[model samples]
Target: MSPTATTPPVLTSVQIPCCVCGTMILPNAANQCPTCLAQEFNLTERLQRGPAGQKHIVIHQCRNCRRFARTPTRYEFAEHESPELLSICLKHIPALNQHDLQLVDASWIWTEPHCMRLKVRLTVRTELLSVVVQQRVMVELHVQFQMCPECNRDFTNRTWHALVQVRQVRNDSKKGLAALEMALAKNKTIRQHVLKVDTKKNGFDFYFLSNTHAQTFTNFLQRVAAMRIQRTTKMVSADNHSNTANMKTTFMAQMVPLCRDDLVLIHRKAAGSKLAGSLAIVTKVSSTIQFVGASPKRTHVSDSMMELSADQYYKTEKHYQMLQAGHRLVRFVVLDVELCDEQAPSGQLYEGPHSGVEKYALADVTVARESDFGVNDEMFACVTHLGHWIAAGDVVLGYDLVNSVGTDDWEMQEQLHGGFTLPDVVLVKKAPRNKETAAVGVDEQEGQKRMTKKRERRKRYKEGRKQKELEETAGRMGFFDDINEEQVDEEGEDVDADFEAELANDPELAAELLNLERDLAQLDDGDVVAEGEDNQLVEEDNQDS
Candidate 1:
C-alpha cells in the first residue's frame, strides 16, 4: 500500500487589547494584560464588603492585666503566633467568612511591642468566570489600651466578692492544713479562681473574684478533709436607683481537731453510746475519723472500731478530748518481738473495722525509748497490734502512757476506779530509717563511702535550691493576690521520708499526693528543656576546663 500523506495541525492564538494599557494580550476574564490589571485593579478594595469596612482594625486590650478582649463579654490571654490570637483576629475580618473566598496563607507582620500595633498578611484566592484571582491583603491592628471590667474591679477597693477562711482547731501539727493545701494545688479549677492566698498563723485565707468560685473551693475542702463550714454574707454596696445590692460572702471552714495517730479519750456522757468511754487511736482521717480501740481489756472481737463523721464531730466536739497528740509521739526502739500463736485467744484476729489490706498479728513486744537506749536500762513490755510491721532492732513511734500526766477526766476516772490499767507504751507506726541507719552490718569502708555519697547528694540539693531561688528572683513580678512561691516550696520540702511512708500506708493520702505531684509535673514541663540545656552548658564548660 502507498504511504499515507503526513498531515500537520495548525495552532491559532486569539489576541485582545488591554482596556487600560492598550496592549495586545491573550483573551482572559479580565480582558486586560497582566501589567494593566496589576496597575488598574485593587484586590483589597474589591474584596471589602459586608462587615469588612476597611483594612484598619481596632482591638481592645487591658493595660493592667495584659489580656486581649475577644468580645465584649470575653477576655483572653494570647501570645504572638498562637492559634487563639489568630482566631480572635480572623473573627474581626468579615470578608474571610464568605464561602466563595479561600484563605491560602496567613502570617504575622513584625512590629515593635512598644508601638502597640500589629499587622497580619493574608493571601486569598477566589474563582470567577473560570479564572482564578489571587491577592495579598494587609490588615492593621491598633491596640486600644482600655481596662476590662475585671481589671477595673481589681483596682477598686472591693476587689473580691467572696472570701474563704480555713482554720484548724488544733494547730500544733500542720498536717490537716498541709493536706488541704495539696488538694487545692492539685485542682486547677480551684487554683485559677483563687484571686489571692494569704498564709496566717494557724491557717490560710483565700479570696475569690466570684461567690461561685468560693463555694466550689469550700465543697472541695469538705471532700478533702473533715471540716465544718459556716457561711455569712455582708452587703458591700447598694444601688437604690437600680434596685440592686452587692453582697460579699465569707466562708469559714474549721478542720476537725483529730488527726491520724492521735490518742483520743471518749467522755463519760457519750460512754453509753457505741464505741465510747474508752481510749482509741485514730487510724485514718478523711471526711470522717476512723478510730480503733487501744484499750488492753477489750478483746480482739470487741475492737470498738467506729467512724466519726464531720457533722457528728462538730455537734459533739466537747464530748471528745485529745489525750495524746500525734506530734507528741516518742520514738521507741524494738528490742524483741515474741509472736503469739494464731489459735490462742489473745492472738485471734479482729474482724471489726480492719481494711483487710494490712495483715496484723498479735505479739508481745519488748521496747525501750530510743533516747534512753544507752542512758538507762528501763524497758517496757506490751502486746501490740502492729506485730506484722514491728521487729527486733526496728524503731517505732508510740505514746509513753506511763510517763504521761493524767490530766483528762477519763484518765482520772481510770486512776480512781481501777477499772483498767493502760499499757506502758502503745506503739502507733514504724519510724522511717535513714540511709546510714538502714544499712545494717556494713564494713568501715562501705560506711565511709555511703557517708561520702550522702554529702555529695546534700551538696547537689543545696545547689538546686540556690538555682531555684535565682529563678524565682528573676521572675518575681507580683500580682495583687498572687500566692507565695516560698511557702509552696517549703511545703514541698517538708514531705520527707516519714511523710512519704505515711502516704504509702494511707490510700486516701497517697491518692491526694499523687494528684498533687501530677499537677506540679505539668506546671514544670516547660522548664525541663531549659534546665537540661543549662546543665549541658555547665558540663561542656567543665570538660573544657
Candidate 2:
C-alpha cells in the first residue's frame, strides 16, 4: 500500500496583553504577562499573610537539653536536613493545606550556625484562573533559648517523681555494687527512664521521672541480681477542692550480703538438712546464691551445690555469718592442678545456673600465697570447680582461712563440728591481670611513664565531670545530637585499662559494656557540639522541583 503524503503543520504565535500592565505576552490561560502575574502573586507578600504571619518565626529551644519546640505542647530533637525537622517546618505553614495550593519540594538552607538561625526553602504550586503557578519561598527560623519545664524542675531539685535507694547489706565489698551498676547501664529500656544516677557511699541512688519507671527499674534489678525491694509513698501535695494528691514513691532495694567467693558459716538450722556442711564458699551470685561446700570432708559432694533464694536468705540472714569477705581475699599462685574423675553419666554434665554453656571439671589445686612464694615454702591444697580455666602459673584469688580471724559464732560452730574441718585455702576465680603493670616492663622508667599516663587519664576524667553531667542529663531527656564516627573511635580507645582487662575474661559482660560505652560516647559528642560550638548544618543538595 502506498504511504499517505504528509505535510508539516505551520506553528502560529498569538500575542496577548497583560491584564494589569497591558503588556503583550504569549497566549496562555492567565491572559497576562509574566511580570504582571508575578507582581499579582507575590510569593513573599503572600507568605507574610500565611499561617506564619511574620518574617521571623521564633523557635523555642531548651538551653540545657538543646531540643526544639514548634508548639507549646510538645518538644522534639530534630537534626539538620532530617525529615523530622522538615515536618516541623511544614507544620507552621497552614496555607499549604488549601485545595488549590500544593507543596512541590522543600529543603534546608545553610546559614551561620552561631547566628541561631535556620532557613528553609519551600517550593509550592497552585492553580489560579486555569493557570499553574510555582514559586519558591524562604522561611527564617529564629531560635530562642528557653529552659524547658524538665530542666527547670531539675535545677529546682524536683526532677524525680520517684527515688530508688539501692544499698547492699554488706558494704565492705563493692563487687556486688559494681555488677548492679553494670546491669543498670547496659539495659537501654531501663536506662532511658533514669533521670539521674548518684553514687553513694554504699551503693547508687537512681532517680526517675515517674513511679512506674522506678518500679520497672526495681523489677529489672530483681531479674539481674539478688535483691529485695521495699516501697513507700509520701504525699507531695494535696488539693482539697479537687480531692487530688500528688505522691512521690520511694523504693529501697537491698542487695544480698553474700558475693562471689565469699566464705560463709551457715547455721545448721538455716541449712535445712539439705546442705552437708556448715562452711561453704559462694560460687556464683545472681537472682539466687550458689554455694559449694568448702570443708575437706565434703569434696565429693561439692558438685551438688546448694542454692539460696533471696527470700530465704533474707529471712535467715541473722543466722548466717560471713567468715571472710571477698574484698579481703588473698592472692595465690597455682603450683599444680590435678583433675578429679567425672562421676556423672557419660552424656550428663553438671552445670551451675550462671555457667551458661561452660562445662566445669573438679580438680585439686596446690596453691601458695603470692607474697610467700619466694619468702617461704608454705603451700596449701584445695579443691576448686574452675578446672577448665585454671592452670599452673596462673594467679588466683582465694580465702586464706588459716590466718583469717573468725567471729565468735564461727569459732563456736567450729568447736561444735569436730568431725568437719575447714580447708586451709578456698580458691575462687582467676585473678585479672593488672594492665598498668603488664603494659610496662620491670624498668623503672617505664613504670614512671605508666604512672604519669594513669595520672593524666584521671585528671582528664575529673576535668570532664561537669560536661559529662550535662551530656548525661541530655541523654536522659531523649536528646542525642549527631556524632562523628571518628570521635566515637577515639573515645572508645580511652577506656580504663584495668576495666578492659577485667572485661577480657567475660565476653558477655564486655559486649554489654561496649554497648554502654558507645551510647555514652554518642551523648558526649552531642554535648560537645551543643556547648558554645557551631551547630552542624548538614547541606543536602537533593531536592525535587
Top-scoring candidate (TM-score): 1
lDDT of 2 by residue, 188-229 (tens): 687777777765546667888888889888988898789888
Provide the overall lDDT of each model, using Cα atoms, as 2-decimal numbers.
0.69, 0.68
The 10-residue segment with the lowest total lDDT in model 1: 473-482
After superposing candidate 1 on the true structure, give the runs of residues whose Cα lies further than 4 Å from its correct spot.
1-72, 76-146, 271-273, 296-298, 335-341, 344-357, 360-366, 370-379, 407-411, 414-419, 435-545
Q: What tens-digit string does per-residue lDDT give for candidate 1 at 1-545? A: 99999889888897888877888877888887665565455567644432546555677888998888888768899986577887887776677878878999888888887787777788888765445667788777777888888878777853888999988866345567657766655456667777766655467678898888899989988888998999999998999999999999999998897778888777656633355655778888888888766654425523556788888887777778788765456778999886654554342333445745235555678999877866999999977767667778988877888777774345456522246456778887776565333312223354356556545655667656544433432222122223345544552253233444444434455566666657655656756778899999999999999
Top candidate, metric lDDT: 1
The pairs that clash in candidate 2 are none
| Residue 304 displacement (Å), model 2 | 4.0
RMSD, candidate 1, Å? 13.0
Each candidate's TM vs. the true structure? 0.58, 0.55
- CA shift at 219, candidate 1, in angstroms? 1.2
